[model samples]
Target: MSTFFHIHHDGDAHGPEAQRIHTELIEPVMRDLEERGRLDRFYVLNFSGPRPFVRLIVEPRESHGSNLAREVLASLRSRARELDFLGEHDIQPQGKVA
Candidate 1:
């Protein structure tokens, strides 16, 4: 299974704010997970369609399962909330289900 973070962006705000979040918030955590062999891949993508934003996808290692992935994703979501990237909500769960 995979974990996905759907990030909301404010175009009016400076671009680096989002960039900083990726560099400072997301990357290190992802790298740590990767180092532990928990994460297979993680990426942030920007789309040009309606309501532009970045999506973070975490694919777990072959030895890792969806439960662990969800736990890590949950931690990331909480961190995003703490960082004010998400309000009370805004971090949505998407894609294929169990």
Candidate 2:
């Protein structure tokens, strides 16, 4: 399965806050997953709309599956909260995609 996190922002896509989340939180986790061979594919999608946002998609290897995605999502939630970039309502899951 594939899981995703939608990160909403009020500022521009290239703003410091967005960059920080990408660099400080997302990249490191992605690198670790890649190094461990637990990742299938990942995508960072940016959108500009009434509520500008970024979508982080993580598809783990079948051997790891949704469990790995769940763990990654949890870790990201915690880190985002700690960094004050995300609040409880900031992230919304779009459910599992096969």
Most lDDT-accurate candidate: 2
What TM-score does model 2 achieve against the real structure?
Answer: 0.81
Error of 1 at 35 (Å): 2.4
What tens digits encode model 2's per-residue C-alpha lDDT throughout 7-82? 7877677777678768887888788888999998888877777887778988889999857867787777787777
Structural RMSD, model 2: 2.4
Instruction: Report every candidate's CA lDDT.
Output: 0.66, 0.78
lDDT of 1 by residue, 1-98 (tens): 66776666565223775676577667877888888888888778764445556677788877776565566656667777676665535455566434
At residue 49, give the lDDT of candidate 1: 47
RMSD of each: 2.9, 2.4
What would the TM-scores of all predictions be? 0.71, 0.81
Deviation in angstroms for 78 in model 2? 1.2
Q: Which candidate leads the pack in TM-score?
A: 2
Worst 10 residues of 2 by lDDT: 89-98
